[model samples]
Target: MTDQFDEDTGDYPLVMPGPLWKRFKQTLADFVLLLVNKCKSSYVFDQRLMDGVIQLLTGLADSQVRAFRHTSTFIAMKLSSALVDVAFGVGGSESKEYKT
Candidate 1:
């Protein structure tokens, strides 16, 4: 008697699954697109916009624990700081204009 594994219909060793690296790269690229789109669409200091960006990055980080967790930490901190700077500058300028 011999064991048989069908390549076409049953479990097979030759079948190629999706590559993890490609998926990770795609997620990173999509994050860049989301960031660009968000920046281009608004000039207001809306909290929801910042929350959405953070959530998107966090979700990507969660999806690939080993490859992106550390990198995401750095990215999140830098982005948050940049957002704060922009918000402060805009608010300060707006208040000055009102005073003038």
Candidate 2:
């Protein structure tokens, strides 16, 4: 499958549809890396970043048309918990918490 990245925002857009499993794996990996970097750096977590994460998770949750509701519910639960942990500074792993 081909990947599409937005030139202006450097955001990867799901231009082509693919298998649910593949999309889920890729999205999860991308999110994990982003979270790790964000936690390690002194970067301020802004609304845009949060929005993008939410959107990505939502897409992953709704990837399967047959079980959209169930997938979305599960994803929502995980996302909520993750957000809480991040807010409380307990989500990032020790190794990923500091970059320097």
Identify the candidate with maximal lDDT: 1
Which residue pairs collide, candidate 2? none
Q: Candidate 2 lDDT (Cα, whole model)? A: 0.53
lDDT of 1 by residue, 1-100 (tens): 0124222342221122467655654565556545644673373245787677678779756643433444566467656655666667678989999999
User: In order, what lDDT does every prediction score?
Assistant: 0.55, 0.53
- Report the error of model 1 at residue 87, Å: 0.3
Q: Write the per-residue lDDT of candidate 2 for residues 1-100, one digit (tens) a residue.
A: 1124222332222333458666875585457545645663343266666677678667755553424434455556655655566655654465566754
Tell me the deviation in Å of residue 13 in model 1.
Answer: 32
In model 1, the Cα lDDT at residue 8 comes to: 31
Can you give the lDDT of residue 87 in candidate 1?
64
Where's the lowest-lDDT run of ten residues in candidate 2?
A: 1-10
Best by TM-score: 1
For residue 90, what is the lDDT in candidate 2?
Answer: 50
Model 2 regions more than 4 Å off: 1-44, 56-66, 90-100
Count steric clashes of candidate 2. Answer: 0
